[model samples]
Every structure is written in structure tokens, then in C-alpha cells.
Target: MPRVEFGMKTESGEEFTINGELTDDELLTITNFVQSAEKLLECRLVQCGNFLPKKITWNQVSGFDICEVNEIDFEALFACLHLSRPFILQKEPWSYNSVSGILGRVFSHHSEVKRELKGLRKIYSDGALSYYFDISIQEKSIFDESRFLSWLNSYQYHRDQDKSVLYDELKSSFSENGAHHIMLIRLHGKLQAIEQLTHLCKVIIKSSAKQS
Candidate 1:
């Protein structure tokens, strides 16, 4: 087992680390959580974010360092796992007039997602921290600046490919911190690639405590 170390901090400012090989179950739990978050991104849940809760509840699960924190900024927690810290957590709201207005425009074609949500079903995560976070949503994303910026890079690319999409006019969604997103994406990719490889190979992940 390759040694993995996590730097954890509590809401009250206590910090500690859990460094070791993860049990099979702990690795599986974290894997599932991440998958869910990725699915949300693919589904374009970022457009439906206004309905997301401002605050979410969290409880530590089977593993990781024993940090007695209640309100770890969901974004920051995962940012560490990605090998960097996000300087900003709060994002600019989407420019649509209302949540539904954008959701309708965005998902009008994907009637299946709407119908299924009405029917009650849970999606899988590619990176959902739900195992540790009770509820991380579109409004309060689990992505650090790197991940979000990476998504935006894709979005802008696709938008340029197809300008006729109804929800393509979401420019107002960027916060003042948006300027640094592109820089983060380019540099962060170097850090993230090695992490995925760690799943299948004996890779030593590097860590730094620069982030919250």
C-alpha cells in the first residue's frame, strides 16, 4: 500500500493528519463519492445551482484524519485531495433571471433527467464527497478552483462549437475571482493526472498545506 497522507482541519482551527494505506472499503467509498460529483458536472447541474443550499451538513466517515471540523468548506476539502487549495470558494451566480429559467433552458431537451428526478433516483458520482459531506450541491460545489475552471474551459469550448444553445448566455455566472481560473486549470492538470494513476499503480502522492 502506498502511503497516503491527508491534511485535515476543523472548523474551530484544529489540524491533524491521517497518513497510511487506505482499507479497501475506504478507497471504494471515496471512489464512489467522486464519481457522483463528476456525473453532476456531466449533467450540467452547474446551471441548476440556484436551488442548492447555502450551507451543507458534514460528518466524517470511516477513515481520514481525525479533524473535529463541522464546516470544512466543501470545495477546500477536496482541493487538498487534488493537490492544491482554492483561494476562493463562493462562485458568481448564473446570470439567468431565475433558477428555473436557466434550468428550463438548459434541460428542456433532457426531459429524462427531469422525469427521473420527479421519480426519485440517485446519480453516481465521479467525485462526490457525499461519503464525508452530507450535501454538496451546485451552489456549493465540491470542486476547487482548478476543477471548476477546467469545467469552464470545456464549457467555453463547447459553447463556441455551438452558439445556438439556449443556456449558452451564462456569462454573468463568473465571480471576481474568475480571472485566475484559467491559470489554475493549466497548472492543476499536472497535479490531477498523477492522482488518477494512483488508483491503479503504486504512485506516491505529494501534499502541501497551503490551502484551507
Candidate 2:
């Protein structure tokens, strides 16, 4: 039988290499396992890499390998797998707000975001990180900077006022780190929310200039 090799990190923060033949049974097992884990963790299965027979045929698979089958919940795992398969197969544009919604749900469910926020809070209690905005631009323009700064300032002001609506406005008007963050989590994929954000910024700048 031809063999394939891949690597994965377990929940315990341990790294292990997986080597085996690619068979329908193995595929189904992996799919089932990933599905269960996703339900327990409320996330999605993202393919990290593929193994072909050519790469592993000659070399002995050797490393600090540890193997164990930790207990798993089968039902929840399959549910998450089912929810995620369609999204994985389709190529669709993800909006900033929609991405944010997905992430909010994940963070609330997983507590990983909460843990990170706690670490950040220990360093900066006043939420100074809120002031930092990442703006991606293809071409530098004074008008673009002005509009972006204005939008950012407006967002900050509303945030300070405890306005719930500002979250949507800011996410829609400016790119969201959370959206990009979640895409990385859910699909193990990179999202061009920054590109979409820059495009929106340019449109806003052009429209503002036309009005003047």
C-alpha cells in the first residue's frame, strides 16, 4: 500500500506526525474524528496539507512521535463536520460583518479569545489596543488617509460612548481583525478582508472628493 505523511497538533499542545495510506476508510475515519472535535470545540476542519506516495515511499518516518486516542464525542463532531463541508467546497466572498458574526460565536463558545483578552488586559487595562488600526492600501493617497482616519476616529468616538451599533458600522466601514482571525481559525485559510477594506476606503474617498 502507498503511504502518506502529515503533521498535526493535538489539543494538548503536543505535535505528532501522522503516516498511513490514503484509503476511503481512513478518510471517513478522519472526517468523523474532525467532525466530532469541531462540535466539542465549535470550529471547522481545515486541511493543512496532502501527502502523496512519492514523498514517503523511500524515507523511514521517524520523529518524536507519540500516539494515543483521547476520548471523543462522536455526535457533536459529525455535526460540525456537516456544517463545514459545504463552506469548504464553495468559493464565496465573505463579508466583514458576516465574518465577525461567525468569529463572535466561535470565541464565545471556545473561550480562547477570552483567554487572550485576559492576557492583554493584564498588560493594557485601558484597551489601548483598540486605537491601533491596520489599514492596507494598494496605492498611497492623501485622500485615502484622511477618510480612513476620519472613519477610525468616528468609530473610536462611538466605541467610547458605548454604542452597540458602532461595532457593525466599524466592521463594515473598516476591515475587522476578528473576521480575518476567525477565517484563519475556521478554514485555516487567509481572508482578504484587508483588501475589501482598502477598496471600500477608496470608494469612500472618491465619493467624498466628488461632493466637494
Best by TM-score: 1
Q: Which residue segments of model 2 deviate by more than 4 Å?
A: 1-64, 92-212
CA lDDT, every model vs. true structure: 0.31, 0.31
Write one digit per residue (lDDT tens) for candidate 2, span 1-212.
22334344557897765333333443333334334333323332222121111111112454111122222333433444345432222232232233233333333533543353344332221212223322332332212222322322344222333333333333443245432221122222111222222232233233334433
TM-scores of the models, in the order given: 0.22, 0.18
Which regions of candidate 1 are displaced past 4 Å? 24-29, 52-212
